[model samples]
Target: MKMKRKWTPSTRFMLIILYFEFIKETITVPCPASLHTANDVKRCPRNKLEWNARAARLNCSSINQTCVDPSLFEYHCVLNKEGNQLLEVCAPSKHIHEQKCTEFNSFGKLIQASVINCSDALITCPDAYRSTEMYKYQACYDVVYQSTRNEEAHCSSRSTEGKSHLGIAVGLNGEVKCCSGYKWSNRTRLCEKCTPGYTGPECAYSCIYPYYGEDCFKECDCQINLCDHQLGCTPVYWFNNCPHQPEYEEPAFTNTWKQRRDFR
Candidate 1:
C-alpha cells in the first residue's frame, strides 16, 4: 500500500561519484617521515615517475649514494615494494653535530654517578683529549663508520690548555670558534685560514678595487679602478723594439724655411 521511490538518472550519477570517492580514500599509499618532507606527498615515488626512471638508470641507489653537501641532509635512490619503479629521496640537513648526553648536567657531569652505560653517556671531549682506549660510556666516535662503531672521548684539563695561535677549537657552546689569528668562515663548518684579499671574522669581507693582498694590506700601483687582483694595469707599450719618439717643439719661422719642424 506504500508507493515505491523511482531512481532518476541524476540520482544514479551522484551515487556513482560517491562510490569512487570512497574507493580512493581506501586505496591511498602511506608516506614515511624519514623519506619525505611534510609538504611532499606522504608516499614513495615522491617525484615524477619519469625522473625516478632517469635516476635509476644512473645507478643512483641508496647503497652507494652519500650526502656531502652541508646544505642537503641526505639523498638516495630507492625502489618501491613492487620493484618496477624507482624513487629518489632527499632531506634537509640539520645542525645536530653537537649532541649532549641524556643524563649529564650542563656542566658535563653525571647526575647519579652510575657505571659506564648504566646512567648516562659522557660528554664528547675535544679530539686532542680523546681516549686511545675504547670505553662503553664515551660519547665520541670517528666521523666515518658511525653506524657500525662508536668510541668514547675522555676529557682532561689538557683539553683546555691549547694555544690560541696553534689551531681552531670548539667553544663552550660547541660552536666552531677561531683562534686569535684565524677567522671564522661562513662557507665552512669550522674556522678557516682566509686567503689573500679577504678579511673579517667570517672571512666574507674582500679588498676593494685598489687593494689586493692578505687582509687588504697591499695597494695596487697601477691606474685607478683599472688594477687587477693578480695582474695590474697593462703597459702602454709592450713591444721592446718599439721606437721612442722625440719631444715636440714649437713651430717657428726661419730665414728661408717655412717654420721649425716639430719632433714627435
Candidate 2:
C-alpha cells in the first residue's frame, strides 16, 4: 500500500509561482539614450559598419560641423530583451579614456575612476580611490561633476577657506591645488584643519597651542623657571608673579605623641 503524503501551507506556498509576471521586466527595462523625450540623439551603430556611420550620415564629422560625439563615444543606448541585444542601460560610450580612480565621500562627491565603460562605476569603491586630497581629515570632498545620473561626474577640489561645499579650490590659473595648511577633507568637501592642536579657523590654520608663530610650528622656550605660557616663556621677558613678596617661614615645631594622635 502507498502512503499518502500531506502538504503543509508553507510548503504549498513555496511551490506556487505567480502567473503573468515578467521577472526581468523591472531590471531589463530599456534605459533611454539621452534622458529627453526627443533629445539630440541618433542610434550609435554597434557594428563596424555602423561605427562612424551616424556621424557620417549627419555630416557631423565633416570638420565644419560641431558635433560633440564625433567619435560616437558619448552615445547612449536602449535595449530589447525579447530575443537578445545591448541597449538597456544609459552611460558614456567612451571607448578610449584613460583608467584612473579617485576617491570621494558620501556627501555627493563627483569623483572620477577608471571605468572600462561605465560598468565599473567607482561609487561603491570602499578604498583604492581618493581625490587629490592630502588627508581625509574630517571628511572627503563633494564635487558637482554631472548634473544628472547619466552624466559623468568630474573631480573638483574647493578650498576650505572659501566654498566648503560642492566645489574644489581652483588656483588663480584654474589649476587643482590644495590650500596650504588646509588638508582636503573627503567628508565635508572642504579643506579641513590639520590634526588636533592646529589653530586658526576650523580647518588648516596655525599649528597648535604650544607651537606658535608661522603655521603655529615654532615652539616657545620655558627657560630655567617653570614655563608659564602666558607669563615668561619665549620672547616675553621673564617676570615672576610673586617676585620678592613675603617669604613664608614656618616656626620650629616640637614633635609630640599627643599632636600626632590629634592630627590623625
Candidate 3:
C-alpha cells in the first residue's frame, strides 16, 4: 500500500523563507618606501601619496597614530586602524617671538667686564668702567669696591678713625677735618659755614660786635636816652643830674652888726 504525504504549518513556513549573509575580514597595507631622511622624504612626491594610501588602509578610529620626520617639509605622519603610515606636510614654525637683553648702555659710556650669576639668571659685566675719575669706585648691587689707589688710601685714612669707606662717613665717630673743607664742632655733627652773626668752631658762639651779652642774647645799648630804666644803669652812667633849689634874699646880717656896736 502507498503512504499518503501530509504538510504541516511549520513545514510550509520553512519552504517559503529564503535569506543570505556575507562577511569580509579587515585589510592592512604596508608603506611603499621608507624615508631615510627628512630631506629625502620632502623631495619625493611618492612620500605624500603613499602616506595617504596607508592612512586609507587603517580604521577610522586609529587614523592618527603614525610618526613622521619633523625636518621633512614640516609634515606629520599618521596611521589608520589597520596600522599604515601617512605623511601630512605642514608649514614651518612661525617667527612671532624674539629675545631681548635686560640692560643696555648709552654711547660713549663704558661697561665693566664681569660675570654675575644670581638665582636662575646670568649677567655679563660691562665692557668698560663707568667713571675714570680719581677716588671713585664701582658700585654693583650688594658689592662695593674701590677702583683706584687714591680711593683705597682715602679708605685707609677713614679706617684709622674706625669709619666706613663708603659714599659718606656718618655718626659721632667721624671727625671733621679741615682738609675736607670742614671744621669739627663738639655740638653739631654736620658741616656748615660760619654764620654772619656767629664765628669760631662750627659757628657755635656769636661774634662780638653790636651784640653785648653772652651768646649775643643782649642787644646793643645804643639807645638815644642816657639811661634805660627797664634794665638799670651801668657804672659809666649811674648818677642822674641833680635839680637846683630856688634863691632867697639876705635880710638877717645888717641888724646884728648895728646892735653889737651900740653895746660896745
Candidate 4:
C-alpha cells in the first residue's frame, strides 16, 4: 500500500487560505447571464456593459430610465415579485443588503448602487404583517485590497450584518443582543422565530391582548382582557382569594434528643 500523507500545520494553513480564496472567487464572480432570478443573489457583473438589449425592452424610462443601463454600474431594477413595480436604488456589491427584500424579484440587478459609504438599508414588512427574518442593515469594514508596493491598502464593506434579528447591534462594537420577541440561536447564528407572546421588529411590541403567538394568530380563551401572549389565559386563582397556608415554626427546643424525637 502507498504511504499515507500526514497533514502539517503549514499544510493546514495553506488549505484554509485556498478555501477562503475559493469563496472570495465565488462571491466576486459575476452571476451567469442566463441566471436571471434574484433568489439569494450573490454576485454581479464586474464591469458595466456597453449596452443592454434587455433595457430597451423593459421601457422603464417613464418610471425610472436608469433601471436599464448596465453601463451605470450601480443602477439595477428591483422587480416587485408580488407586483410589477420596479424600484431603482443604489446598492453597491459590497453594500448589498441580502435577504432583506427577497420578496422582491431582483431580476439580476446585483450591480452596485449609488449610495453613501456604509449606509443602512431599511426594509419593512407590509401592513398587518411582521417579519421574523430580515433585520436593519449595518455595514462592516473588510479589506477590499491588500497593500502592494505600488498601491495602498483599500477596504470594502457589506451592509448585511450578522443575525437577522431586529434591533441587534452590528459589528464588534457592542454585544449582539436579540430583541424581546426574538431569541438568539447559536446553531443558526440568527435570531430565530418569534417567541411566545411576542412579535414585531426586535420584539419591540407585543401582540394585542387575547391574541398571542407568532403574528398574533393564536386566540385566547380566557376572560376578556385577561389573556396572556404566551400562556393564553390568566389563571382563575389569580383573581380569587385562596386560603393561606399556616406558617411553620419549630417547636420549643427539646431538652434531650429523646424529647425531640417524641415531639416529632
Residue 2 C-alpha lDDT in model 2: 95
Report the C-alpha lDDT of model 3 over 193-240, residue by residue, as the tens digit: 443444332344332223333323343343313322222223344433
Per residue, candidate 1 scores C-alpha lDDT tens digits across 2-100 of: 999998999999999999866643332222332332111111222343233323332222432233333322333222222222223433222111222
lDDT of 1: 0.34
lDDT tens digits, residues 1-264, model 4?
A: 999999999999999999996674334333333133222211111222211222332322333223234433232333234322233333222223433332222454343222222224233322211111112211111111111111211111211263233434332333345433454566766665576766643554455444667756786654534656675655553345324322456656644766868889
- Cα displacement (angstroms), candidate 3, residue 103, comes to 48
Comparing 2 and 4 by TM-score, which wins? 4
- Let me know the TM-score candidate 4 reaches against the reference structure: 0.22
Q: What overall lDDT goes with each candidate model?
A: 0.34, 0.31, 0.27, 0.37
Looking at model 1, the pairs that clash are 31-42, 73-93
- Mark the regions of model 2 whose C-alpha exceeds 4 Å error after superposition: 1-169, 196-210, 217-264
Query: Which is superior by TM-score, 1 or 2?
Result: 1
Model 1, residue 133: distance off in Å is: 64
In candidate 3 the C-alpha lDDT for residue 197 amounts to 44
Candidate 2, residue 231: the lDDT equals 28
Taking all chains together, each candidate's TM-score versus the true structure is 0.22, 0.19, 0.14, 0.22
Q: At residue 141, what lDDT does model 4 achieve?
A: 11
**Once model 2 is optimally superposed onto the true structure by TM-score, how far is the C-alpha of residue 231 displaced, in angstroms?**
15
